[model samples]
Target: MQSCSSALCVLILLITTVTTSSGSASLSVTVKLNDSATLPCSERCSGLVTWTVSHKPTDVLAECDQTSCRSVKEGYQMIHDQYLKGNLSLTITDADFTKRDWYTCTCNNKDICDVALQLEPLRSSVQMKPGETLVLDLDVSDPVEVIYNSRANGSSGHICIVDRGSLECTVEYAQRASLTSALELKGVTPSDSGVYTIQVTRTEEVIHVYTVTIQDDLPHPDRDQETVVPVWGIILLILLVVLMGGCFCNVVVLQRRRNIMQRWRKTDGQRKKEKKKEKWLSLT
Candidate 1:
């Protein structure tokens, strides 16, 4: 009979522990980068109400009493009027990647609200010509991996990893890639066209995905300049042809003048010789 009574008491204690230990999931918030976020807790607080990191219970983030409210850290606050009523929402100004975590609210040391805060996943597209540099923002200080998914062959692989401010890429990208808060690929080619994903290395949670399209190779600027004929060069060639034509015309005119002079001299000599012969015949 005593054993049965003890068992009943134990079961009752377990039921009570389960019910009181869990705070009601009052809110789930997802905000964009640098956006404001409100973690809500709808519970009346007659005494001191405190908000803290769920994992770090002793570190209070915000607290409110009947008279006023205070935020223990920057970028976080609890309103006075809301606490007087039934709302204990903590607002984070300029929410970012570093602020994503689970938070808990307590009123008089009893759990009242549990909130899960997260940032919206980033997605964007980019178009790049071959031989141009492709830059992608890492957007996070924590360690992460950049993955490539080829659109041509439907293959996928990791391009690089950023950890502890160091970046390491695969053998294919080692020579042409660099990372300093952003990933840069120099002299990109059509073969580099694909999707890039930035994910948390530890959790494999995707933070951002980029669709990159590398267009066909462009003509080299130096080569194009070499092939193009300059306007000044064409003008000089035209002038040379004109000068040669003028020289030919002058030579023809000089030859005609010389021929006329020679013909006149020969005719005068013939007339003179005839006169002399006539005189000699008259004398005879």
Candidate 2:
């Protein structure tokens, strides 16, 4: 009998551990937007479990209903409860910027347990060189998508679609300008120089934005060269040199013809022979 009781106690302990590990009474909360959060409620105990929010050991904000609870704490108001089959999520309506604080999620049927709620920041910063490519390094999260907006100077920017998993943005602009990834400019001129802002969004909430500037000056050129000219330009230059040489050769040929004609008119073959005989007699 003693052995049987000991075995039964061990079995009960194992069962409790398995229940806790296998999503029996687990809770996860994600705070985003003004007053929106998702709370994973207990799946084992099927009954009305109350959810509560506490800022610290002392500041308690709300209590849950059969589904979930929404209430006003300080200035922020909880909007609705998405009490699905197992989820006890709360959407806080009219989220206040000043109410950025820690909130604890507690669930109670008979025994009360709490889980920590955390908020993910939506603001992002990026550095880009003028005329250089823009590569975005995104924060790690699932099903998170980012939207890009590009602008130059003080003008309006453009929006673009980005892969949720791809964390890079590359665009070429002719002139220096601040462009938004959300906005793409073909010829970024010097006047386009300024801040380029890229706003990243996941679902409907704006998650992050990256800002970069394009300059009018070519960034890093070869020491002895400006921007790289196309091969066709070099070929054209060679053709122009060849044409100029041909024109010079034609002018030289015309000048030689004129000299020969003048020499022939100045003296005939008979005059040339007479002059030669006079020179020979003087020598004798």
lDDT of 2 by residue, 227-261 (tens): 77779999999999999999999999999999998
TM-score for candidate 1, please give it. Answer: 0.66
Candidate 1 per-residue lDDT, tens place, 1-284, comes to: 99999999999999988976664665679999899999988877899999898899899988999999998988889999988988999998988888888899999988888898888879999887787998888887779999999988999999899998788999999999997668898998888888999998987868899999988755666888999999999999999999999999999999999999999999999999999999999999
lDDT of each: 0.89, 0.48
- What lDDT is reached at residue 277 by model 2? 98
Residue 202's lDDT in candidate 1: 89
Error of 2 at 201 (Å): 24
Clashes of each: 0, 20
The TM-scores, one per candidate, come to 0.66, 0.30
